[model samples]
Target: MTCKALREGGAQVLAWDDNPDTRINAQSDGVALTDLDRADWSEVRALIVSPGVPLTHPEPHRLVRLAREKNVPVIGDIELFAQAMAALPAERRPSIVGITGTNGKSTTTALIGHILKKAGRDVRVGGNIGEAILGLSPPRAKTVFVIELSSYQLDLVQTLRCDIAIWLNLTPDHLDRHGDMAGYKAAKFRIFSNQTSEDAAIVGVDDDHSAGVMTRLKASQRQSVVAVSSGRSLGHGVYALGGKVFDALGRSPRAILDLKEAVSLPGAHNAQNIAAAYAACIRLGLLPEGIADAIRSFPGLAHRLELVGTHKGVRYVNDSKATNAEATAKALASYNHIYWIAGGRKKEGGIGALAPFFPRIEKAYLIGEAADEFAATLSGTVPNEVAGTLETALDLAARDAAAGARDTPVILLSPACASFDQFRDFEHRGDMFRTLVRARIGNA
Candidate 1:
């Protein structure tokens, strides 16, 4: 999409990918089949690398090394789009809201986009969430772009200053890509690295790492920072207190609406997501009443704590997007008693950090490549069985959850591992889970 957007902006675009099946290749003006070893690098203006393109961790891609050697500027799609948007007139240009964190980025981005659209604004949401940014039509006079940016995308951006910059919360994730914890945090911090005092910076002060990032941003003194908390009353930002959303910066942290009013938005993690979206909406000058209504009516995004259906008393949730341990931990925390279906191609650190939530699991049905390793980790801590595939896992989990003593029992497929082992991607895995759940539970 970035390449196509650049082409539409009247720049010559050349796209090269080792894989021929890439969607970007089809959208490009010209394709280069030449390998990094064989292609001449002197003619290119800038090399637009994918966020998935490794530049530092697990060894940099050959193309990146070639770019470095040839002195060609290596950049990502976000930077290119940023430059394109800057060339347009300020009023004609779209307002950008960039949301980043270890988790809940997609939900918050979708929520912000939903609220803006509900208030009758022209909005397009894509980037690290659903559609590619370039796939959407260019911004018009009233268009607002709600972008979900990953640390990788933020790392490549140079001039992408958002009107509203949000940092939901930071945890140890994508460490392999960023090299270390400091490097990972540094990438996330880049979301607000270029913002000035005129822009709004929303920070969630829930975890120590996020709090530390907020502290540094406060020290920088460039952008106006609004601190939100999930556990406490934030005196000058959006927060959840006594199940009601509140804007505390004004008189008395006034009540906006009760979270229960928003049926789709549940759990404490989602409350933080709601708070972030509300903060962004208020910063963008939307009325509180309108924003609250949008929050109440907006349907949640798929594959992240999504309620697929209820069979008997068991509620099946498809959270296959939780491909990392940290994300799965959040999903686990959302439910009190879960028949968890987890395991896949394991990342580093395994499920060790998820030990805190072990007691909540009624029984774990492991699947895919990481099954043995996950079962080993849960030994003595919780009961687990290796189900090998998602189908078996789902079958076992659903039956176990149905028979269990807890009311409102949950069958959660929140794999804390990547999906490459069994499926093409996370979405495919999530879709398959949802389909199987509906077929099994709906029939029963």
Candidate 2:
């Protein structure tokens, strides 16, 4: 898309990929193929690299180093879109809401866009979830762009400024890409950069890193900042506690919504998502009651604690998106008497960090490359079996959960590892899990 846009702007596009197959595909799509190694670096305007490509990790890509040497700005697709938006007339440009964090970013981005759409506003949502930023319709004055940004995308962004910026809680993730936790936090912090005093910033203060960000932002007073929390009541912000959502931005707290009946949104992580979404929309001038109404009716994102079906008195959930221990912890806490199916390509800390939630799992069915490691993590704490493959794990979990003593034994697939060991991606893994569950125990 970036290449197409650049070519459409009358620039002679030169594209290359390390993989010969990728180069062939690009050439077939009308992108002029060039051997970047032999191409003149001085003639290039800018090098638009994918977010996945390392700018400076174990070692920066050779092209990146060359681009740097030639003083060519290396950026990602998000940055390219931002530059395009900047070129547009100010009065005709759209307002943007940028969301970033280690978790809950997708949910919050979708929730904010959903609320705006329900309020009869012209809204387009993309960037890091459903579609690429450049693939969305051209921005108009009345149109609002709600974007979910990853840390990698954030690193390449410079001039982009969101009218409403939201930073949800952060945890250790993609450390190899960013180098360390501090570097990771710095990348997430870029969401608040380039903001003006007129703009608004909504931050989740539940985690230590996020709380520190809120404190620093408050101290600077550069933007209209609001602190949101799902665990406790704050003096002046949106908060959720005891299944009730509160608007505490006044002299007294006011209840706006209740999540006790929101089946799609379960657990405190979602509560934080709701609080952030509510605060952002309210700041953007949407009515509190309208926001609450939209949130109530909004169908949640799939593959994140998605309730597949209930069969034979057992419930099935597909949370394949939880590719880290922190995310898996949230899913584990949302249910009791859980028949957990976990394991995949291992992560840094493995499942050792989830030791606290072991008591809630009635039994665990492990699979993929991380099975042995996960089994060791749960050895004396939670009863576990190395099922080796997702197919076998799902079958075992379904049968065991059905025969369990608990009235509503929940069979959950919240693997705390990447799906690359056995599947293409998290979505593929989730689809297979859903298919298996439906075949084994007919969908409700």
Q: What do the candidate models score in CA lDDT, each in turn?
A: 0.87, 0.90
RMSD of each: 2.1, 1.2
- Check candidate 1 and list the clashing pairs: 1-134
TM-score of each: 0.94, 0.98
Error of 1 at 257 (Å): 2.1
* lDDT score, candidate 1, position 47: 83
lDDT of 1 by residue, 101-150 (tens): 99999999999999999999999999898788878777888788999999
Clashes of 1: 1
Question: Can you write out model 2's per-residue Cα lDDT over 1-444, one digit (the tens) per residue?
Answer: 888888777888788899889888898988888888899887898888988899887679999999999999999889988888878888988899999989999999999999999998999999989989988988767789999999999999988889999999989999999899998999889888889998999999999999999999999888998999989999999999988999998799999998875678999999999999999898888998899899998888889999998887888899999999999999998999999999999899998888888889999999999998889878888988999988899888877887787977999999999999999999999999988988876543
Model 1 root-mean-square deviation: 2.1
> What is candidate 2's TM-score against the reference?
0.98
Query: On a 0 to 100 scale, what is the lDDT of residue 97 in model 2?
Result: 95
